[model samples]
Each structure stands twice: as structure tokens, then as C-alpha cells.
Target: MANSTTAQALQNITGTIALVGAGKMGGALLTGWLDGGLDAKRVVVIEPAPSAEISALAAEGVALNPRQAATVDTLVIAVKPQSFRDTGAVVKPLVGASALVVSIMAGTTIASVREVFGGAVVRAMPNTPAAIGRGITVAVADDNVSAAQRATADALLRATGSVEWVDDEGLMDAVTAVSGSGPAYIFLLAEELARAGVAAGLPEALSAKLARETVAGAGELLHRSELPASTLRQNVTSPGGTTAAALAVLMGENGLQQIMTRAIAAATARSKELAK
Candidate 1:
């Protein structure tokens, strides 16, 4: 467990944290916590199936499968939705009223988490780039959450990326569609851009490299720049330049805006279906 001194660094949360699953997203959160100055030994990982991932967690100096279960202040659940039922029983005994649960399982609602663990629950959806601390995560918690729990969650999540909280759980599905599944959509754009470059007579490798780098660099610029995305885009577009020519097609009727809106709506609906 984390020592008293480390735990006391906060006003609300002041105990060890148990990570229920150390898979990709869970591992990412653990990495963030460790890198963000949380004591490695304070993390207790409870992964049963993947011994390899568990071994990795052990290498981080975290407690693996601790015998004592009820001592955790925060119990984070990052398991897949299909496995939640089986995993719930195993985790139930470890949860206490004082413990807060922050789950990253898609389509797993706070109600489901409370029913299983009977503790304050926060449901979140994070992207894959969180592996390197560049993802975005959106979370929502029930009334059971304390101010301390929310702060603790924000601190932990900020390690991986930016954190945004929604007032209504109903908006989580839109968040899931926009940010949770948004990365793949962006990657698809890069792929198509590269293909278009190749079609325009550029070498395949160079086209791919240029497309990837352009998107990555543009994203970095957006991160650092003070201007809004629309302003930055307008700054690059001229009255009769090549960019404007492309923008005309992209921004025209039956264009990217409508396409993206429909795609996000579809994804949002799927998320709601999964929750049901």
C-alpha cells in the first residue's frame, strides 16, 4: 500500500488504488499514474487471465493480487464489457462504500457498476493513443461521487490525456462516438490522403510518409497554437489556391460535415444499443 505521507498528499482520497484489469487501457492508466508521481507500490493489479500483463505490472513494483481487498480507496475497472459479469463477482468483495470506482469499459453504465460493486461509480471512455499519454477521455459520475473522488479521477486521467466531464450520462454515447472511436476515423483520413497522393503520381512510400507526418504535425500545431481550429484552417486557405480548391469539394453540400454527422450519429446509436 502507499504510505501515509503519499496518501496524505490529497484532501479527499488517501489510500491505495486497485486496478481491476491491467490490459491495454488499464496498463496505460497504470503507466500514467506511475509517471505522474503516484507511488508504484500503491497500485494493486487484479488481472487473472493475462499472466504476461500481470507480470508487467509486477515489474512496475505494484502489488499484484493482494490478499487484502477492502483497503483500496479507488477501484478502477478497465475490463471488456462482455467479461464484466464474471469479473464483477470477483471484484465485489474488494469494494467498500468509501471506495470509488472509475471504469473505462465502453457501454458499461454507472448503474451497472453500482449494481455490481455497490460503490460510487464513474464511467469513462478513453482512446487508444492513451498508451503514449496523447489520448482524450470523457467521464461521468453518479451522485455518490465526492468532490475528492472527482479530483482524484481528474488527476489520474490527466496523466493519459485531457479530461472532460459531462453533466449528463446521456451525452456519453456522443462522446464515445466522437472521441472514443474518433481516432480510427482520423487515421482513415490519413490513409485516404496518402492514397490520393499516390494517385497524383507521388511515390507510394513518400506519399504515405508525407500524409502521416502532415496529419501528425498539424495535430501538434493545433495543440500548441492559441487560435481556434477554424481560424487555423482559414489561415491556410487563400482565395484561389490549391487548398481552397480542395476545401470547396470537402465543404460543399453532401460533403464532410454531413458525412461525419451521420457517422457519429450511427456510432452514438450503436453505443446506446450496447448499453441496453
Candidate 2:
């Protein structure tokens, strides 16, 4: 689920936009849509058990489980993969033939969505950092999606952070392995760094503070800089310098790149299995 919002995708969502889930990612996206000028009245959330946040949103004029299957312009499937068995039967008939089907659930393939819903479909993967509007989403859409529909999808995804599009649905598994699961790696880095610092005699609080801020600051720099990550790394490493010494180990034969490659491969394999 996305943590926050940024870009505005739709000026005015023109019809009843049914959201099948209102958990974190779904809620984050709906918040973005409402904030971006999609009329609150135009939305219908279908969470059987609404969270307090979702319940609060209902007061703003959005419909919560109207109990009848009405044709909607778009049906966004953000519910968990395990719950799709129940939800698909309930949602499939409610969207019109011309409706756009956007699914952000991991491991749920476009083919699966089309088979069940049979409409123009866009499948996307978004990370948890989206809760703060700093996540990245990778999306792939079917050939039938109109330019307008694609734009709408892009706007919706971009509310979290940046968005990337890929033509090959095959790559989405790797995308999921990478960006979808990438945040934990950065977090782990900060965690291990702090642990290492503590091991080197620094106080635990100081070590954690330094590691956290240093990681965050470096990320901000990378975000603001035009230079590639390699270039930035090179700039920080002087000959035989402390940074270079650290890099020597990090970029070693048994270092981050190798470990990351294995981690991503395992994740990709699991994603494919889940697709089945």
C-alpha cells in the first residue's frame, strides 16, 4: 500500500469508480484520487469490513457497499490475492464492458484479470513506501487500453511516487523482486550499519541515529542529483580513503551485488509460483 500522494491523475473521475478494497494501498490510492479532484461521490468502496479510515472517508460522500451491482466506469482490484476468489465473483459483473480494470495485487497476472473480468486491464506493482508518497510503481497494460485509460492509470500510480511502464508482462516479476521488495534492502542496510557501528564501540543510540540519517540523507542526495549511483559512489571514494575501504568490502566478490542478485532471483521465482 502507498503511504502518500503526489501527482494528480484524474481531474474529475467521470463515473462510479468502484474500489474493491480499502486496506492500506487501496486507501492510499483513494485518498490520492479524492485529493486530486475525483469527486468523492463518484467512488464506491467495496470492503466488506471497512477500516476506521475507510469509514471516515464515507462521510465525504463516497459510497460504501451500496449492496447492488451497478455498472461502474472503472473497477480497481486492490484486494488481496487470497480473497480474489470471493471478490471476483462479486465484482466481475458490476463493471461495464467499456470499463478499465486495474489490478495492483502482486502475483495476479493480467491474463488472470482479463479471464475473470474481460476488459481493458492494467496490472501494477507498488511498494509499501507509497504510504508516504515515495514509492515507485511499475505497470503493464493490455493492448486494448485506450490512451486516456493509460493516462488515468499512470496518474493513479504516480500518486505514490514515480511510475515506470514496461511492455513485457514477463518483466513484472523481476520488477516486483526489485522495486516491490527493494525497500527492505535499504532498511536492512541501515539496520546492519547501525549494528556494525555499535560493535565498533559507539553507543547504540548514536549508532542508530547516524546510520538512519546517513542512509536517508544519501537517498535524498541521490534523488536530487543527476549523477548515476555509480558516479555518486565514485565521487565519495578517494584513493585508499575510508569510503573506498568500505566499498572494497561492499563491492567485493561476496558483497552486496552478489547477495542482491540471489535475493532478487529467489523473489522472482516465488512471484512466478504465485502467478500459478
Candidate 3:
């Protein structure tokens, strides 16, 4: 969980909040808000088919799509890119001119959001780890966004995890390729590591246990350490050690670096394509 600073920052959203999607990321943000002491009565979620978690939230006093549309102080849109075209108009009327509009949809630019729903538009990229309050989000705000509104958006995003503000929205695609999609990449690595361990004669269960723990432990170490990742990697490698032997193959010319670069590039291109 993020500290009280984030919770305190969220207090500025004292009016009404309208969240347009109650799926994973949206649900995670909503959960974080409620856990942080935001008044449940002040929030309204616009979900077509409510999940059990959403039903529970509604029971807790967070409004689940009241019939009459009311103006909100903050409008948060977390719908899929394709669904935006169909749902955007319905949500536009719910926002007041002074309200803050933050979109967590990937590949949806601030200009695009502003075109559909006019307000202080912010574009954010948040990863799935947000469900557990460990995600990292990068956000960019349009010129229409005020300093106060930007801070409000920052507070909302930080409820889920760390928040980074970027001056250039164009860099969001790179952010998407790295952090937004990076968790899946790490999970794939863990899977392959376990398989390789099994191939080396270790039992399947033992291999899986070793792989999961190694990756989890390394991530925790990295999180706690002030040292750069490269420095930490060097610290783990002894002269002619097993780690060094593994690094030789991984650091080879046509190796992890090249593979990662190509992967990010492909992801960035697809993100650009989606914007079109």
C-alpha cells in the first residue's frame, strides 16, 4: 500500500467521482480508493455487468450507476480502446467543465480523450500489478489540465502504486512497451526458467519452486536496494561463476538485449497503430 501522503492527496477529490469501467484496473483503483478512506458515497461506478467484487462495493455505499446522470468533479475512464467509441458519448454528459478527466486506456491519447469528452484530460498507463498496490503508472496531462487537477490525478494513480509524470505524452508508448506490458514478459521469463531447470534434471515441482522463489527474491532485493541493477548484477557474479557463465549467453551479441529491444519496438509500433 502507498503511504498516507497519497491518501491525504486524495482528499481534494471531495466532490463526486465517476468511474466508467469496473474491470481489473478500474476495480483495482476503486479498491485502493476505498481502502484509502475516500468516502464510498462520493464515488459512482458505471459498469454494465457488475462483478461480485463490484456488487460488494455497491453494498459498501459506492453508487453503482444511479439512473439519473449527475455532474461529477472527476471523471475516470478505464474502458478498452475499442469500446471507447461506443461508450464515450454516454459518459461525456456526466463531466462538468471544471472537472478532471483521467483515462487509463492504453494507446488512447489525451487529444483523443479530449475530443470525445472535453475537460482536463490526462493519459495514464498502469500495469496489472495495480491490483495489489504494486503497479507503476506513467501519466501525461494535456494543456487544459490545471496544477490542482494534475495533483488530483497523481493522487488517484498513486493509490494503486508509484506515479510518474511525463511532459511529453508521446513517450507513453515506450512506457506501455516497458512497464505496462513488462509484467507479462517477466512472468514468461519465470516460466522458461522453470522449464530449463526441469530440463537440467531437476524435478518439475522443485524446478518451479526454485524458479518462482529466485525471481521473487531477486525482485524484492532490487526493490530494497539503492544500487543500480547493473551494479547488483555485477555483485552477484563471481569470476568464472555459474551466474557469469549464464550471463555470457544472455549477454551475447544476438541475445537478451536485442530480443528486448525488438520486443519493445514491436509493442511501441502496435501502440501507435492503435492510436490511429
lDDT winner among the candidates?
3
lDDT for model 1: 0.84
For all predicted structures, in order, the TM-scores are: 0.92, 0.93, 0.97
Residue 216 error for model 2, in Å? 1.1
Report clash pairs, candidate 1: none
Against the unseen true structure, what C-alpha lDDT does each candidate score? 0.84, 0.85, 0.90
* Weakest 10 consecutive residues of candidate 3 by summed lDDT: 64-73
Per residue, candidate 2 scores C-alpha lDDT tens digits across 76-124 of 8889987876788888878777799999989999988888877899999
Residue pairs in steric clash, candidate 2? 1-25, 2-130, 2-131, 3-130, 3-131, 3-132, 4-131, 4-132, 4-133
Estimate, for each residue in 48-83, the C-alpha lDDT of model 3 and write its tens digit: 998998988877889987454478889899999889
- For 1-276, candidate 1 gives per-residue lDDT tens digits of 222332334223458888988888998888777766687777788887656655876776788875755567888888889898888888787778768889899988889888888888888889998998888899898998998888888777767877799889999999999999999998999999999999999999999999999999999999899999999999999989999999999999999999999999999999999993
Better of 1 and 2 by lDDT: 2
| Cα distance off (Å), candidate 3, residue 119 | 1.0
The window of 10 residues in a row where model 2 has the poorest summed lDDT is: 1-10
